[model samples]
Target chain A: MGVVFETVVISFGILYRYNLFKREKERLAFELEINKTQTTLQLIATQEAERKRIAEDLHDALGGNLASIKMNIQNMAPGNTQLSTVVGLLDKASEDVRSISHNLMPPEFSETNLKDLLANYYNQLNNRGSVRFNFHTSGIDRRFNKIDELMIYRIVSELTNNILKHSHATEATIQLIYYEEYLEIMAEDNGVGIAPQISDGIGLKNIQSRVNYLGGKINIHSNSFGTTIIAMVNYKK
Target chain B: MGEKIQLVIADDHKLFIEGLQSILDNHPEVEIADIAENGKELLEIVRKKKPDVVLLDINMPVINGLEALKYLKREFGQIKVIMLSTYNEEHVVEKAKAQGANGYLLKNVNKADLIQTINLVHLGQSCFPYRLPAKQGLPGISDGFLEQSNITKREGEILQLIKTGLTNQQMSEQLHLSIYTVETHRKNIMQKLKLRNPAELMKFIISNNL
Candidate 1:
């Protein structure tokens, strides 16, 4: 009886130790995943800060110099044909540089008119002729915090960019539906769909992280017929 | 002319200052009263020259643009300030506006807009070149929120000293206060800013562009 009781206690001890180790392993795995996501988000934030710095430099330093040069030329020769030609060329160069800088750093976040911002964003895509975009919005009359607006803008922008790059379909649609509790964003492309075994590339990861940053939910539906990404984020007012 | 618009252009970049001078060279109603490399010198020149308009850069070596604006408007209310910033971060703009800045213009503004904005500000019209979205209602530095929080001037000074890596003893010496007084001020600042510790305070400062 004593030997049997001792053996039973040993087995129970072994079982408890194994369960503890397994739980620890699972916790560590979960922690590693969280850390990876955090690192990716930090990287994206750093990239944005760097881009803003560079864009501002380009817009201020080089663009300011060009404007000063144009001013000097205008002051030097108001009606001279040659100077006018140079000014015209300078004007074109200035516009091109401005567009590039603006693209790098989207317009200031305080632009209150969502419709206007969307219009400008879509108009910018006119340079890329192959992609046809249809944008629609509803129930978006209320204002959102600046950070929230920027995040939403970035998500839509990235999703549209992905569709343009990966989707073979010539047409895409982006919709923003605002409800009392949350804002729903949808991007759909009628082209080749994402594969099931596809790894999370930088683009998808960026979208996911952005959605995570906004404390939102994301759903993706992909098949041979088409692909669509739907994200819902609360207005962090 | 009856009187040229007296202008003091304060920027750390000498070349940019020169470029701005050249742009304003032939203007009929504007004159370059002085050029300052930093906020300290800008304040000195403002005191001496009493310029009608001060074109101040946001990023400077000693004392940033927002602080200078605060001091300038507080000391010389007649002098109009137009902030010249390379980037239009919304918080910075809102802060400048709240600090009594007469106008805000991008550093890359064309000569025409720059001149017009300066003239407008000189004539006592507030101007903001960038469009802030309507309805978001982001608070400014001196917004009602700050007023409600009741952060004192001493606390603000201490917060700035903390940001500059000044120890309590050093801050006390700089501000002509006792070390304990400086410590009290620091504690109050943290409380007013709703920061739990130094790390949180620093994060708050960076995030808020303070």
Candidate 2:
């Protein structure tokens, strides 16, 4: 009886130790994951800041100089063919700068709502006419935080870009359903679905990271017909 | 009636402002009151001088043109404000109009048009080159929507091309029409439908199954 009791106590000690070790391992893993996410979020913020700075420099500095040049050239010679040609080239360069800057950083989010922003972007895509894009939104009359809106915008852009590049899709639709606490983004396209191998590509990965950053989960449903992506992000005002 | 139009120009770009100043100096009917480098200074100058016209740049430091326009219109409603912007965006133009701007002119406005617009605004006339904002509310796409809207068959074809994301140049190449002709058709379609921009046009097309 004494030997049996001692053995039982020893066994309990071993089990407790094993449980403690397992908990420690899980804690370390959680810490590592958190550290990794922090680093990634910092990187994303830095990238956005850099992009914004570059866009501003291109728009204000280069754009202003180009406009001044055009104005000067026009003032110097109202209709001189040589000067007119130079002016035409200047206009083209200005347009290039504008587009590049706009792509780098869209117009101020404080100035326009997300729906208009998305609509404008889709309109631009439709101008390419490769795919017919439709955007529908409900319960988005109110605005979200700037960062949240920008992230959502990027997600949609990335998804559409993927479609434009690979999906061979003729029709695509992006729908935003806003609830009280969370926003659901559903992007669907009618084309050859994303292959399993291609699903691991950088585009989708970028989207995944963005969704993760937004504290959201993304589910991708792909088959021979097309692909549909749904991401739900919980947001705070 | 013989008074020279007193003008205060506000812009952040020194070179562009100088170029504009020289152009305006050539006009005998216009007189320079002062120049402000930003919207804040613009308001200050306008307060002191009470200029007849304020040529405000949309993008400026310290305070933006739109905000200053609001202040100017409220404090000194008599001072005519002409938005001198590099952007010809329809929304921006619409915002300016809604904010009580007397006129809207592109930064690259020619000497003749610039002078004409300023004079016209000073004389209590509103000048805007772009089409006015259409009525709010999307028209439902019924079966006879196109017919009711008077969209022509050629216009319909162009609309289809536009839906396919074809640029005017590409459509011209494919359809054997000049870019100008394609643009005309597009404009006519938008006017008939009373759609403001391509996005609305696309939305209408998709909703109507056109």
Question: What does candidate 2's lDDT look like per residue over B1-210, in tens digits?
Answer: 348999999998998888787777657899888999998998879889889999999889999999999999999999999998766555677789999999998776666788899899999999997553332222343346675664444567788888899999999777655565566567657766778999999999898877
Q: What is candidate 1's CA lDDT for residue B193? A: 59
Cα-based lDDT at residue B26, candidate 2: 52
Model 2: chain B TM-score vs. truth?
A: 0.64
lDDT at residue A129 of model 1 (Cα atoms): 50
lDDT of 1 by residue, A24-87 (tens): 9999999999998788768767877888888778876777677657656665655689987887
**B1-210, model 1: which lDDT tens digit per residue?**
539999999888766776788777868989998999999999999989888999998878799888899999999998999998765445557678989999998765666788899889988999985552332222234544444554443455666677888988898677655554455456545655567888998897677665
DockQ of 2: 0.13
Q: Global CA lDDT of candidate 2, please?
A: 0.80
Interface RMSD, every prediction, one decimal place? 18.3, 10.9
Which prediction has the highest lDDT against the true structure?
2
